[model samples]
Target: MSIKQFLDKILKNWPVKVTCFVMAVLIYFFHQISTIDKKTFVVPLEVKSEGAMVLSGGYERHRNVKIIVRARAEQLASVSEKDLRAYVDLSSQSSAGQHNFPVLLDLEERILLMDPLEITASPDSVPLSIEERDVKFVGIRPSVSGIPSHGYTLSKITSDPATVRVEGPRSVVSKITYMPTEEVSVQNATSDVTKKVSVLNRNSLISVGTGTFSVNARIVPQGMVKTFSDIPVSFDNLRDDLAVSGEPVFVDVIVEGELLDIEKLSADSVRGSVDCSFILTPGHYEVPVSVTVPLGLTVNSKSRETLSLDVVLKPEETLPDSSAVNDGEEKDAENTQPQEEMEAVPEDVTDIPQSDAVPEPQIQGV
Candidate 1:
């Protein structure tokens, strides 16, 4: 056919021909898509900051992302969430305010081999607040719970590395006053309790330099106070000739010790006394009261700090009068002489009258 005739034949029924060709392309495309499969995955969204910038609050909602991939069945079987990485780059961001960043994806070499694959994410971009990085040193407070064993009490609690350094966004780091450690239980503990616990950070944006700390709890016996009343005060190191002349001194003693030890104490067990050895002569004086208690007990207080008493000499025995003894001896001698003279004339004077005989020997009787 001539060139003009050939061109005319090609142009013949151009509308119908174009329509048929479009139908065929559509049919082929539908047929190819029928064999493809789709899959969904949830993955963590990483943030990359090459400079001193970070994502502040409201970023936790965007921490994870949902990814959708379309590929042939065989290709989709080899794909997994681990093979893909999603992140937002904040390397160039330095301002301190809210910011919106586009989500980026990185596919591994093996996943990239999936030919004719389609991939898309649910959220193409996320909104985040970017702020300047900050660092602060905060004290660590240990958390303790539960009571100790019976007859025991918690004495003190201590933590090693009492302070730690925290680094995060300026806005979040500035609000934190102190860090708290995980709880440690001392239930039914007889002795000391020690543990290594983790530090808890309520804010997701904040990062701690040290993740863990050492905690030590001291447990000891419970203390109690016992009041011993009516303890009599005694004289210690006093001379035998000297005596304390005053009302009987008594004191009320207060002692403190462990519960078990204090329970065994009584009024009689506590002794109070005063030192009288310092007084050389007998006189009125104020002596300090000294108390003695059982071993392992502490004296808390005393009712009387000092005792006022009068020290005096003891009374002596009375003796007989010397003049009376001399008079008796002289009268006895005079009676003895008269009795001897009467005895010599007694036989011859027997005939005399009774009154006359007595008058003759009327000497003084001793």
Candidate 2:
């Protein structure tokens, strides 16, 4: 119809037409209001390292999420966030394998008329698995256990609890053999060694290093003995311009060890020193002396007494013309010095090296 005809028809029935339009509008508005009261929960999602059994405000196992539901307000006042839970319909959809992805929300029966106001249930997922790890065992390595205590010689060392159990990945578990103990260093020791030590390893495959192991050390006995030989005298770095003035320069060979060692060693094991060349001419000289100890023996020396030397230039050799030599006395000072000397190793030291050595074992803690 043309616009004039449509207008004429509406004007002829304006009251009824307006009444119909108003009814239609009222129906649409009521339809919109009917949809408002649908009850649904929106709980906030939360995930935890292990499990999410959180405490409520009053220290209960369940927590609450504030949610806004379109349900009846009267029903809501009677309900709480804790009473309702999010219903993730995984029952129909299969994102989770055989396991159920539990809805973290506390859902109420659909018969309830309440809706959650400000609904927000946080989302969360489960761990891959919930099983505890297994335990495992491994071998042990003990060291620094060889040195002895003061006055005692270590004879032998051994581990008592040698093996430990651990658990973890199969690959890493296979690569490991033994765990090492912390380094033990005991000084001036001459006694049997013993200590409880821990193993060192950090493989998730093994857990037994968390435990303890026993270490045992053995030692031999020998009583007091003197410093076997005199101290060895060494020459410090010197200028070539200054020359030593003697042949057979002296150096003391010092030997000191466990008292028993000094007593058991022999002079043959120790010797005094003399210079390499008789050509020493002017300044200080250092001579070398060597000491020999019986097989399987260790030596230590104190600096109480060191070997000295008496040296002299040839008596017939005239003094040099230079003022450096003749400035004071006009005589050859090179002739004034004496050759080196040292007390000979006592009969005890000369024999110990050859005589039944069986020196003590070491049980050092480092």
Candidate 3:
């Protein structure tokens, strides 16, 4: 059959054609109505400021609004938080004060609005205090806690970015002088360490550009033992009448510290002593020796761990005896009695026995 003849045959029935056309129109309208939907969403209400300014003072909290949008069901199903944006324009508010503004909505092509969405904010209009935003560079201070392991000491603690930029409302930014990092612990740290530490947030209004910083700590081994000999040992709290003497008058002190500190030490820098305050009576004792050193130095061991002292009481004076004195005087008198002196004999002359005739021969020789 020819195309025109077939079309003429189909159009031959006017009432049937009108009914079919009306049915098709009704189906399209019903489909369109089925796809249309109304949904209520809670979205953040952001404020777009014209210049570098912030909302300060009275209202410190952020605001959110409830929006009812009319859109196709398929598009609404695929919609996300980012797709719906609500904001209050603050371009006209250039000075610091209170002001009321209208809320604006940004939507996509699929979204349709039958009527304005009703926002149940505490204040339907935006009421805020505007202030100039200020930024300042403040030093970051790190707080250290705990001690290092044995035989090790902390040498230095530092941060990579010593200072950070803080941007916030003028009042809050001016109040902040310095920023501080979270407390870092060096407990049981035997060697050098580096870590990332978060900066503490002192105030919510103030925002720090750098949230985290690097912290490094240096640990070094304590120097070798240094021995200082001949450190004079002294006694304390001894009685006046008692005398104390130790076997070793001096002691050897061993200390461990930094190399520079240990090198500056000498025998005279250390003092060793034993307390005798408890000894009321004189006797011998083995007392523990205590040593003292300069700052930045630690006492480890001593050559003479204990001191041995012989404490004795001074002797009392003896009383004079009357009979002994008299006997001494009589002896002295006997010794004073006259006595004959001995004469030397010549080498050539012969010695003769004492006799009365010898005395007469001596008178003849004279």
Each candidate structure's TM-score, on Cα atoms with residue i matched to residue i, is 0.77, 0.28, 0.49
Residue 78 C-alpha lDDT in model 1: 84
Candidate 1, residues 1-366, lDDT tens digits: the string is 899999898889999989999999999999889989999998999888768998786677887998898888888998988899999998756687777788899999877778778888768888888889999999888999999987789999988988999988887899888899999899999899999998888877878975678999999999999888888999999987888997898899889999878887888778999998898779999999999988999899999998887999977779999999999999999989988987775455447566665444567879
Clashing pairs in 1: none
- Lowest summed lDDT over 10 consecutive residues: which window, candidate 2? 52-61
State the lDDT of candidate 3 residue by residue for 139-191, as single tens digits.
88887888988767888988978989998779878988788888788898889
Best-fitting candidate, scored by TM-score? 1
Give the range where candidate 3 is weakest over 10 consecutive residues by summed lDDT: 114-123
Alpha carbon lDDT of residue 112, candidate 2? 50
Between the candidate structures 1 and 2, which one is better when assessed by TM-score?
1
lDDT of 2: 0.50
Question: Of the candidates numbered 1 and 2, which has the greater lDDT value?
Answer: 1
Best by lDDT: 1
